[model samples]
Target: MGCGRPFDEVIAIAPLQRCHVMLSWCYLLLSATMTIECLDLSECQAALGMESGAIAAQDILASSSFDEASVGPQYARIRTDVAGGAWCPSTQIDQTRYEYLQVNLHRVHVITCVETQGRHGGGHGKEYPTFYMLEYWRPGRTEWQRYKGHHQNVLLKANFDTNTAVKITLDTPIVASKVRFVPFSEHLRTTCMRVELYGCEHKEGLLAYSMPSGEFYAGHLFDDRSYDGSRNSSGFLTGGLGQLMDGRTGGEFALGNGIVSDAANAEQWVGWTKPLVEFYFLFDDIRNFTALSLHVMDSSNSIKEAAVSFSLDGRHFSHTLVEYFRYENSSVAPGPDWLSIRIPKQCGRFVLVNIRNTGKLLLISEVRFESGDAYDVEIVTDGPFVGRISSPSFEYVWLITGLLGCCFLCALLVTIIAIRQRQRKVTSPSYTGLKSTPQAEHIAVDLKTGQMKVIRDTELWLPFLNAKANSTNVYMFDSDKCAVSKILEAPANVSSVQPAESASTTPLIPLKSSSSEEDSHCLSRKELFFENMRSEYDNPSLHYAASDVRIVPLSKAER
Candidate 1:
């Protein structure tokens, strides 16, 4: 059944052969299999729903004389919010042959696809681009490149049906910082269109590199204390990275503490002593970076002017690569702002930050460099770092709680050990051994220092005299091994006697009764009494006699 075949060839094919060929083709078509796969529609939607980096755009202007009350109100409809009404710029009387819309993306992106929606109003008079072309501008380029298709075709068509949304998918993604849409439509008077850009916010092939170490310096003088590498106080001064990158725009001046330039002599005042300062960043590896950010202090008098440059080698730098950013002091109500410098993508290992002090004081709070996949380049500085969040985190609270608990546990253990030691001292048996010598004269002994003490109390001295007088009967000793006197019971006629000087050298002797019969009887009684007292001293049954004090013979030193 081939077309343009000769008549003779067609006639030669038999009816049976043609039928077989048709059956074979039908079988082949029926036997074909396709692989089906599920797609994450939400993920796709999320990618398409990214916020457009477009800060400003052409073709969004409206003439003040137009019927519309305000100009550029329609520009709001082109943002990420789809619920907002469409952007319908009133063409009014003036119209151009080739109307175009140009968008400044602010930063580079890899554009994958773009979608366009017509006005919500339904009518045959609806306006949209019948034919169009997409173009984009790269960094450092003055010219635009025409977006191409998979087959290298530079032209594209969109919105053939008015009032209907159309999506154009590019065969190949383009890396660009700005994009433009040119509409060549017959409906030029109706210059209204809603467009959305869908793309990866970063280039596909680039790898995200970690932040690098950084140091601060004043001109040629390096300050070792200026090195800082932390989340909160990433700047050479104070504050953190989160606040610096909060995207707050600025125009007025306020005062606060942050990174301030210091002279080699710490006593020298900043700005006056050191009019200029610079920060140096060292990358672990060379990187192709495109943007750098600086967050100045909240004062107009702080960080008035700055410049950034890159170099493969730190010492030698190319003048052509230098970018200057200046703040005009003459401006009314000028304040601190986050300034981002977009540079042509280039590979380098070092970034030099230079600042000129226009105000009486110079201070900068934060610095961030945009490198691989737009990851922030890290800076290392000598710092007393602070946390990024003003409020404490759960982990910090938990850590502190744990430390306190540990301290309490340690203190409890120490207290328990001390209490147990005291209990042992109170419960355990205590015994003390003291040495003494029986003397005819009275004396006292110091128990603590093991020294002989003079008897100042007459009762103590009289006990020894009573013991010597009563020596004629029997000797008696108290629990402390000191002599006890029964002087009140002694007869009044019995004279109190004093030992002679020889008594110092003589051993004390027990006195006996003079009458033999009476003495024998008295001696028998006394011996019986002594035997009973001796049994009492050695008795294990005497529970209260297990005293902590004891007496033994005096040592040579005590004697």
Candidate 2:
């Protein structure tokens, strides 16, 4: 047989090639289908979007109407009999039902407009009809969420042949798939005619620019003498020293003292801003910047306690101390005329130095940002040190002592007044009777008996003295000559009678009269008188004739 190519072999190559081409076409179609489905539009509509121009849309949901049966599936029907027109019973049945619409979307860029309308069949009685809108969504992989958006005022008006449209802009972007609209009532005929949406992109970052001050240069010039720079030696410059105050400028601060001197004859340049004052020093090139020097002098002298701070960004700062010096007889000491602070590393473009004078005087002479190797220096001073005599002032110790003295004086006065009051109370006449007095003695003598006696202390006395008969007998005698009579009356039943011729010589004793029963049975008038007088005298004494003594029965005397 001839070696002709078999028909099967030729066909086999063609079939194989067709199969390969078909398989390649199928692979491409599959890849394209997947790409279309996997692509995400949500990121473009929200904050994560690749483009920088996207913004969010405001979503509004539902609203309400005062009338019953106004906005659901059970549409309201007007009744002519009622003044305001009542919704019919049939129409009220539909009020509970609702008419809702839902839209599913991948990404929502912006909501364009919302338009609604309501029926106005009732007479002028029902002026306007109101409705509401609702929005729903599913965020990320989460379930459905809903929100309400309604205007304060209702949209539709009664008997008006027009619809109301509301527009809203969102403050933030949202990524959602579905949204919904819901009405408040079912009967007051209300409808949403249309809703519109627009795609959007994100916005880019804000442009950075330098803020300018109205003054010239980066440092302000302040004239110490007059209001203006010409008259006053000092004037204020807002931005560094070179730029004008009105327009924006990028410059560094430079401070120079008109004359260089020691602490005595130094000039000061003061620059003050709001709370955060920033000073930038631009170097020609990067070098070994070590120490920063500032010539600062406090004019008020109140700045000794003031805190000095340094900073890089003008936001954060570090603190240091300002040393004070007094010259003696033109002899100068190594005082800190310029503050030398160490800088750690070289900064880019410019170095910002912030000086916050927490002290009384904010005056500065010159500030120098020097390269440590270059030995650069700056001097700033508030002119010459003018001395002013300060008046004498009271110290805290003196004030405290004066207060204590006043308090002590008040306490002493109080004590004296208290003592005087106590003394007056004791000496007052009202309490005199409550006090005790010394007793006085009194003596009484009996004239007829010539006897004397001593009376014991007495304020008051009782009449009728009774005693048992004893050998040592009681005597009644004359005040002067009753000694013999007392001896005779010492014994009971003893009697003594004077001789008739000697009656005048011896004292006569009076005897009880037998005829007078009153005198014999009771106390005599003299005894009663003595008893009554005893209350008036401190002490009393009585004298009687001893010859008158007689023994008698007690029962007879008592009667």
lDDT of each: 0.40, 0.30
Q: Which candidate tops TM-score?
A: 1
The predictions' CA RMSDs to the true structure, in order, are 28.2, 33.7
Report the C-alpha lDDT of model 2 over 351-457, residue by residue, as the tens digit: 44444434332444444443321122332222343222222235645877899999999999999999999999888744132222232223333434334343342
Per-model TM values vs. the true structure:
0.28, 0.21
Q: What's the count of clashing pairs in each model shown? A: 18, 75
**Top model by lDDT, which number?**
1
- List candidate 2 stretches off by more than 4 Å: 1-254, 257-399, 418-431, 434-556
Runs of candidate 1 exceeding 4 Å displacement:
1-96, 122-125, 186-191, 203-559
Error of 2 at 156 (Å): 52
